[model samples]
Target: MPRIAEARDAAAPSSTEQHARVGRILEAAAELAAENELERVQMNEVAKSAGVAVATLYRYFPSKTHLFVAVMLDQIDRMREKFARRTRPESSARDAVHDTLLQVVRALLRRPLLSAAMIQSNSMAKAAAVPDTARVDRNFRQLLYDAAGIERVTERDAALLRLLVHSVFGIIQSCLNGRITVPDAESDLRELCDLLLAEWPDSFTPAG
Candidate 1:
């Protein structure tokens, strides 16, 4: 029993250390991306900043695109969790949707460099073509399920929800690019949400 316990404790530290190392790499990559132009960011720089060898960085992340994609996905997941927690059972669907969109837009704005890198990556465009789109749809569907119960959702409603999510992303991108003002972007999102609610109020039950 003593030997078994010792082995378990030793294994636990190895697992924890691996997690800490990966976290350090990710944090270093984020800081570098934020501080420098995305076009100029290189794997060598990331490895150096991460205090890991280039081979180690490659072992963890196959390519720079993969690394950036992981970063964006992590950011999205964090925002999704935040929205899930902030949305309340007693909150009106429209209000919940509005709040969620605002939160996501604010997060993107906060990480402008990362957002820009994502937008600029041709690899991202290719990734978005299929698997990424499906993953995004799944995430949004889950959000919708949280806002409006799953039983109430239909195929048509799901399609509309996907459209709204894409539109919200477009609006945020436009705002970031200066193609639209912040107030205008907010107005557009509010109008879009209102239209969605009007068309499918039945899908979104008013919280009691």
Candidate 2:
């Protein structure tokens, strides 16, 4: 089969029952990954834990990487919902940027192990995995824009925002993997957001 066809097949949507089964499998995977490293979690164990057969698990997630990627997709969906429910203050864009990025920092830090697994899979994501990663990345970038309190972004601002996002991810991953302390990463994210969003509109009143 062609690469495009294969990619589509790999990322194809599941039926309702299939979706529930996949969710259960991912939950099981999350539980295992939270307690053990990626390599230490076995497919058989996940199936047993999810109360599904190994063959069924395989149909849902052919490999551990795919399983983790699906979990990451779920994570991003949650992050999307968060932004949707978040009430933006009548504050300056700069403040919005600061508060929003800080939200990302706090959320990811709360589940270090689970986030670590997702990050690991992302770092190793291949062509077949691009669709899953792409959706996650798109949702992430959208969240940043929503946080900026800007419905329309100029060409230059969009480019700059993308760059800022990449930098923030690097810093957070470093902290998640223990290459740097959380405080350092948080400080860097704050500074980075401030620098990039310096042009954020300042005309605003505090929301009462």
Candidate 3:
């Protein structure tokens, strides 16, 4: 009985250990990418900084694109947790969602280089080729839905949210490319959120 219990504990530790190692790798990659251009940040250097082997890094992140996409997802997870801790009783669901997304945009813009690297990697990735790419989309939408106090998402709601996300991504890219100023990007996002969410129904019966 004691041996069996010990074996169960030993087997369970790998999951925790693996999460820690992956977290280390992500932190290392984020730090290095923030310090330099995307092309210049090497995977082996990330492994060294994370205290993991090069092969280990590649095993988790098949490519730089996968790594940065995972970073974006990590960032979203952090933001979701942060928002979860706050209270905003005064704002409507629409306003809450708008504020949440705007805050996220500002946070990313604050780290321009890192944001650029992650956004570019996300854009270049295909859902079929990179599974994290699809997860990035799903998690981000869930974040917004949660902010809006939405308990369920309909197809129409999902489509509108998808459009909103894509629009925001475009604005971010434009701002990063120097085609738009920060204020302009913020203004556009505000207008977009208002326009889309204004039509967002509180209750809808699914089509037959």
Candidate 4:
């Protein structure tokens, strides 16, 4: 009986160890995702990169949609932390907002294939149930609130933010399609931000 119990114990890891292993696998998937499209990033590839079996990968993420969403959320969380660190009470709100938007744009540009894959995946029936758009809306609102000190941002302001975000997304897509140079895109974004914010000082209010 003691030998059997020992064998069972050997087969199971402590909860702490299990969490650590999951962390490692998620990290490995993120690294792989930096270079591969979300759809093309298979469980086998994640398992191989993570030094785990395909079953192990599935234990962490049961489907490609799950894995892809997890990866995007992880990346967004990291960016949120970075944005929080870079933004300060003393920083010009416009400059802070501009920097935050540019950082997001650069991240999307760095993983263009992954971005395209995510967009395509969202169009499929299986992807319809994912809370991606809700998460994105929450994230963008939080970023704007924190960076711009506009907690009660008006409907007009929210609409403007959406437009800016979509325009920036389009610019990155255009650059990825070889229609515009990165430098030109960057300059245009800065110009756009400046034009948008030029008249905002008169109406802007600091968050309480």
Q: For candidate 1, which ten residues in a row score worst on lDDT? A: 1-10
- Please give, for residues 16-93, the per-residue lDDT of candidate 3 as tens digits: 788899899889988998878788888889999999998887777767777888888888888889988988556776
Task: Estimate TM-scores for all models.
Answer: 0.75, 0.83, 0.88, 0.71
Worst 10 residues of 2 by lDDT: 1-10
How far off is residue 162 in model 1, in Å? 1.5
Q: Model 4 over residues 1-208: C-alpha lDDT tens digits? A: 0000110101223599686776667677767766876655767877887788887766566556555555555566777888777626465666667777777777878877766544444333132344453565567557766777776777877777777766766787788788998888888788877877665552357566
Count of backbone collisions within predicted model 3: 0
Q: What is the number of residue pairs that collide in model 4? A: 0
For 1-208, candidate 2 gives per-residue lDDT tens digits of 1011133213344688776777788889888888887778888999999989998877656667677877887877777787789687877777777777787788878888877887787657674544576766767777767776556667976787788878987887999879999889878987897788787676433334
Leading candidate by lDDT: 3
Model 1, CA-based lDDT: 0.64
The C-alpha stretches of model 2 lying farther than 4 A from their native spots are 1-14, 203-208
Write one digit per residue (lDDT tens) for candidate 1, span 8-52: 101111577777776777677778877776777887888888888
Candidate 4 off by > 4 Å: 1-22, 51-62, 87-92, 111-128, 195-199, 202-204
> Model 3, stretches more than 4 Å misplaced?
1-14, 201-208
Ranked by TM-score, top first = 3, 2, 1, 4
RMSD (CA, Å), candidate 2 to true, equals 4.5
